[model samples]
Target chain A: MNAIQIRTMAKDFILKEFLPGERPENLTDSTELITDGILDSLATLKLVAYLEKSCGIEIAPDELVPENLNSITQIANFVQSKQAST
Target chain B: MTVAALHEYLEQSARRYPQRCAAVEASSGRQITYGELDALSDQVRDHLRRIGVRPADRVGICLPKSIASLAVLFGILKVGAAYVPVDSLAPPARNAFIFNDCGVRAIFVEASRAETLRCELARLAAEPCLLPLDWSDGPSPLATYLARVEADGLAVDESARPGPDNLAYVLYTSGSTGQPKGVMLTHRNGSSYVDWCSDILAPDENDRFSSHAPFHFDLSILDIFVPLKHGATVFLIGEELGKNPTRMASVIAERRLTVWYSTPSVLTLLVEHGRLDARDDHALRFILFAGEVFPVKHLRRLKAVVPRARYLNLYGPTETNVCTYYEIPQTIAEDRSAPFPIGRACSHVKARVIDANGRDVPRGQEGELAISGAPVMLGYWNMPERTSAAFHVDSSGRWYRTGDVVIEGDGGVYTFRGRRDRMVKRRGYRIELGEIETALYRHPAISEVAAIARSEESGVSIKVFYASRDGHALSLIELKRFCAHNLPAYMAPDWFSHQQLLPKTSTDKIDYQHLMRME
Candidate 1:
């Protein structure tokens, strides 16, 4: 999938799973999920699982930093990079 | 120097190690020495006094975990007042309820949250004075307030200092009722636990402790105070880094943290996602876990990676504060599946297993665990009836009912069976299913609701089953929003199931067992 499609899918999953009842408009692509307390440790792992399974990219243990998963755009970028390397 | 109050630990440490690092922000690498922390807290105490705060008063702290917030906490205690810390990330309404329930005269909060919290408090009858922790615009910030008071050069009133019996802090826990209840802890109660930990851990000024738990959690009691009592440094793990296991692992190695205390879930995350096997430069000497049971599988794996560190399982409710502890053996058999026992009572406290009649149960029999000692809280905040009901009085002494069912194993070791009440531990936070149900009942559309907790491999997940009043379908988003507004995020239900009618027993009570079976 393209970068836009990846961002849309991840955002949709996060909205449906973690931030139910939250307005989609409120969650910008650059919104800091971990810092804003929207996603906790468990939720972060779940999001990682979704990305690895759906995007067909393996995430290394060291790659689980905030720079890669803190925002929807960051997640999409990380996923694209992983896909490109593979 | 003899320590009479909780803040005295910091004072004594400052006198001994003025230039030693006392606190460090893990994310930003900010450091504060003992002298700075002591003087900063003194400024906060002066600011509080200028605002007419006195001994026995309640002050609320709603800021994130940082060195500044820690100073504010010690300042509140120095003024002989109890500090009530609410979750900065929780709903404003919940925080407002806690402030009102405790009748806080003043609150130190983030400037961004001050307006919303002020509006929520306005809805209630009480209007607490809000002192923003940080601000660029609007009301004067805490720094400005403290600086103005410092310029006045007012001397602290030593006569108004708190005694050992005076309250140090009030931590609110989930109540079966819709509202939360504050557990009132005094200087004596806090000192008992801290002294016990210090004696056993034998920490020195060179030790670095990781402050992984939030300020509001009971685990933070050890994270902040124990190290201060020994002139050690506490590394404040910020919220963003706290959720990232990779970053947490890196912080442990990079900062060379010698002491670590947190829930089992956090440690599990580190073991699974942190790549612990890759690093070997850890300076850890003690690893303590509490709040919930640590799975044996994860514990085995963790011990394999960091075999040199001593592991301990500390057990207690917030009302008791580390009344019991167990030292894990160096080796576990590969076939072992059952979790280790909670072990015996701590040196400062006496723990016993009693039957329904409050009489001591025979050895090896299951009974409720009751603790009696200096570590037990004085009582719930302003809740005389609850305080009385929570304890059992006899000729021996008063004992606080823990509501935890356990069995006495070999050699006085107590093995946890389950909770006698509807309370369940999720990620080390005690949650009452009834509280979730009560929050859901507040929604106008929810006619009947029952909340239940299911133990999963990841941890406990709360599922709420509800039926609408008009038989019309309710949106999941709306119900979830309603719950988020009323309860803390941890207490929010993970799943919401719509039912035409909730199953009930012949006595008209909801059949919780039936719902569990369905799941």
Candidate 2:
């Protein structure tokens, strides 16, 4: 899947799992996803799991951060980076 | 004055907020006013009275997070009896040891945990278990009991109540020592700790704190009671956080919560996936955590949004309530390192790093962390020898040894390194492998079980090595998930490994050394 597709999937997962009430159809304002308390620290695991299975990219425990997980867009970029590194 | 009393905090809250909301379920929207809480507690005491429960008796409160659970806790204390909170979320074996070790007279259980509790109760050497939950249409059994108790209007015999020196509750054994050992605490122990901690928190009557952690975990000490004591409202988060984070975030914002306390593992859920920052209402004023080390990266992310909120690191085991605390410096989150310092001891609690010979080590020298103060538990229940060994005494009885390795840096700052024993802290829950296995042995699964702490998060969790009886089959996930239902969430093993044969050590013991080898 391309970055757009990955971002779309990530957004859908977050909306379904976390932001069920605020189903923001668009991830254009990526910051909106996190700043609103729609996701949290435990969601880190789900994001990591999704990235690995969807993009076949492995994320080290140390590499975990909000930058790589702020929104679907950033997580997709992270998968791209990890894929490139391997 | 006895440490066993739970009435002090309750009476204080009742007096302060006779009509103000004291507790609210964030998801269910159920509410409990302070006056109602007081009345409910009276009902709990009355119910216990009907059961022939008396002073210093232990009552096993096996239930989930709700107003009823909180009422039972206070009710037990009101009668000078210590309430043993059992997390219905953990494995049956763990809960069994807790109920049995404490010699619990009666256990108040819900239908959800009826099977697990019934199974464990059957194995208990001898103790009558009562299902307090009533599925009847009229009134909740707990509520009915409380109402009858309230009708008696039994103003607890204040003069007869135990004082500061008495045992408030016995935090039962977890992890290794196989059978759970009760960590004896006093009314004074908890009150003193909460007194100092409350002043530090300065919760106003209007602030809504989250009671998301399990009642069994020590974290519940603060989450369930502190706010009520100060007339601050407490909001109970639905158990939904386990499977969903987005719902949790909505609850946090909707409730207008001011203070939150939970393990870093729970927080990681909100920040990493819930995308909590986008909310308009940021009522959160403080974040207090213990149970496990908070990852620096996560801390940095938390600070980015709630930059002004005070984030604190509370350290200690169930035995010592909380021995040390660190007020997170806003800047340190960004300029951090691995294995961050656990911080200095709390007021009234003293810390001394001691060497192998039990002598005080020099500053910055790593030694077993020995804490002596009001918060240190009286001793382990039923094991005078183990108690004596755990609580060391000198020519003068001045110090208590905390089996933790630490470096007492200059100016009394202490840095936590690792454990001095095989004990581990996962997600802030202490696990002694011996404790989990003790519970496992009760199961008719046939063969053996070994619980180990593989990671910090895997604290108190076991990797069972067992051979099931004919027609018995358990998958790793199913076994672990089963364990989760029986044991407290933290006490439950994270990963399960089944082997055809058990590994043996040179001494002919089941080789825990080989089992600990990372899978």
Candidate 3:
């Protein structure tokens, strides 16, 4: 999966994990994930598994951080940025 | 509270209720009678002694909720050693930190957890023998340890000889510091708390107790030991209880449980969504809640269900082992929070609300609480400086700071307001302010820092507000690195809010609450 695809999947997972209700398949850019309590604690843990399996990338334990895995946008940007640099 | 010693008490109960049921693992549908709990605890105790686990040595217990775990806990106490209970499900690194922090001599784990338990012990530079749970009465590794180690002989005086002065158990609690602090307790403190609880719950031979809290959490001290001391049976609810409250409610009613101990949040979940009918469980006699507040609305609904069962609100931190408690009057349960109150301090425990300067505050003025009594812990294990700071001597060296704000009310009743200190609790873990402050100050772009706990997202969160330096920009990575450098994983703030200048009160002290609300 590409960075965009992974972010969309993570957004979907967070929505289900928190709200536990049906959601739109295509998330818009203006998704208020944190403001609406969509993504919460254990975000980094959930995202770690998803990213390692989906993008074929490994997350260093020290890399787990709120800012780095706070939401779909930051996560996608982090993945893309890391891949680009590597 | 001149209760019989642990072994004597269990022996008496065993003789009295030989055929009556004592322990049950609902997940496995395995039940042990009072006679069985007494017998198994004795076996575990004797086995432990045959090994070299001398009396008063720290023994770590890492296992899931099961009959073996329950038996080992009581057995450890029965033989006179303090058993440190660690939740098997918690992060292995965190558990490893706790094991290292306490310098536990040995740990008993199930076969499944033995690998991880050994790994943690190895990281701590200690060689703790891993005793598996599948002993099947066939070469029980623990049984072998009990048999082989000469030092693991009988408890001092051939019984659990811990008077009020000995360390009962050292519970490792959370902080930003990588090391967790173990709060030491004594047999006397536990018995005092249990004495009050047994009297309040009035558990009889027929009463059945539902154990919900993990053995590690102090709440279980009452749920597991109280029943054993009272000769009542305990229905050991496992991790399955966390998955579905309805299933657990069924266990309570189906098993005819007579006593329940859990957090207010769990009871609300069961009542509101699990559709629990408290009245249906006629066998249940008491419901005790600690670790959080029980809202007034839910109290009424509970009364409507269990009209005969008593509902108690228990309050205290790990150090105090549950000090103040209120037995819910049925009228208050059916009415409003107004009729409810934080009850009087337990027997022999003295409570005083004091100010920041350590002066006793007048009634109705919110101030930090200082508690002095048998229940105050022996201070944090291995952190003498931090322990001394919190556990201090007044003019007479008689008081321990509670860090909680309370107000004196009519008839010696006290009401809780908020905390006077920065150590806040979220999801049942105590957080240290200094840890977060140290983390925030590390941001290269930050010149000064203050972290405070504020209400957020339906729970408590660390609101870290810092003053930014003029030339540098505070990158998110920089901030994360700063916290990751000096604090424990949990002490890191969930949210960071930057400010040009921190607000201050008239006395030049940081207005922490005001700064918290800046965002």
CAPRI-style class, candidate 3: incorrect
- The CA lDDT of each predicted structure is 0.87, 0.70, 0.69
C-alpha positional error of residue B112 in candidate 1 after TM-score superposition, expressed in Å: 0.6
Query: What is the iRMSD of the candidate numbered 3?
Result: 13.4
Cα error, candidate 1, residue B353 (Å): 1.1
Give candidate 2's total backbone clashes: 66
DockQ (CA atoms), all models? 0.23, 0.03, 0.05
Candidate 3, residue A37: the lDDT equals 35
Clashing pairs in 1: none
Give the range where candidate 1 chain B is weakest over 10 consecutive residues by summed lDDT.
B135-144
Top TM-score model: 1
Error of 1 at B276 (Å): 2.1
Among all windows of 10 consecutive residues in model 2 chain B, the one with the lowest summed lDDT is B454-463
C-alpha positional error of residue B444 in candidate 1 after TM-score superposition, expressed in Å = 2.8
Encode model 2's per-residue lDDT on A30-86: one tens digit a residue: 643333333434545766677688777767644565667766667778777888888
lDDT of 1 by residue, B107-135 (tens): 99997899999999999977989988674
